[model samples]
Target: MSDIEIRPARFESPEVQKVVAEALADLSQRYGGSGDDTPVTMSDFDPPDGAFFVAVRDGTLVGSGGWRRHGSDAELKRMFTTPAARGLGVARRMLATIEESARVAGCGRMILETGYLQPEAIALYESAGYRRIADFGHYAGEDGVRSYARDL
Candidate 1:
């Protein structure tokens, strides 16, 4: 935990972009093509309050997530964790970081879109005060995946 450094990542960094691309590639294969025709790039996801972040340990970025303001809501997106980082509370920490960002941005509620293919993600969200919510923002009904939201 002490080695973990959660900080903003730029879409310009090839390393960061590579991690994100790989995750999206997996998503693309899982959901019958890429999730978005014009996927949100890392640059499109960077942070002051609303931005993308990577949780680094030593020197490796092990986890990533982003929060974007969607009108009155802050939508969490692109949350991913490296396999090596699994079982280490990285996802929970990343979610907490995202929630902090949303709170700091003055957003009252946070929502997310996830897939059934990711059972671990479902459990994580459910345990973190999120509940089944109608698809919110752009990812609603695009597929039959589970969507959720939590009030901050």
Candidate 2:
């Protein structure tokens, strides 16, 4: 594999949006339903309060994820790695970056919501020290939605 670089990026950039769309589409199919597409926006990830990140390898966007303030914690959102880059540690790198950035911003913890259909994601978070937590935001009480949190 080529050198993979992860960096803060605008969520609205065309490349990011394209990957987001692809990720959601795959998730929707995996979950047996379509997604509503009504979540956070670019401004929600506009630094200090939040941030978005993308992983690029040899000029191709291979992974993406971001974090936003939710009450006193940083909420991870939009995490995804293209199928072609799934086992290259891209998602794990993006996750670590988000956590480090949140810590710098004084966030004591990081939280995220992923569906039961995404066992790989759950495994990644668990291996990284995240533990089960009560759901928050739109995921609260939503069947099949799994929530996890980790102290930063």
lDDT of 2 by residue, 76-125 (tens): 98899999999999988999999999999999999988888899999999
Candidate 2: residue 96 lDDT (0-100): 94
How many pairs of residues in model 1 come into backbone collision? Answer: 2
RMSD of each: 2.1, 1.4
Q: Which stretches of candidate 1 lie over 4 Å from their true place?
A: 35-38, 41-43, 46-49
Best by lDDT: 2
lDDT (C-alpha, whole model) for all candidates:
0.79, 0.89
Candidate 2: list runs displaced more than 4 Å: 36-38
lDDT, candidate 1, residue 53? 81
What is the TM-score of each predicted model, taking all chains together?
A: 0.87, 0.94
Which prediction has the highest TM-score against the true structure?
A: 2
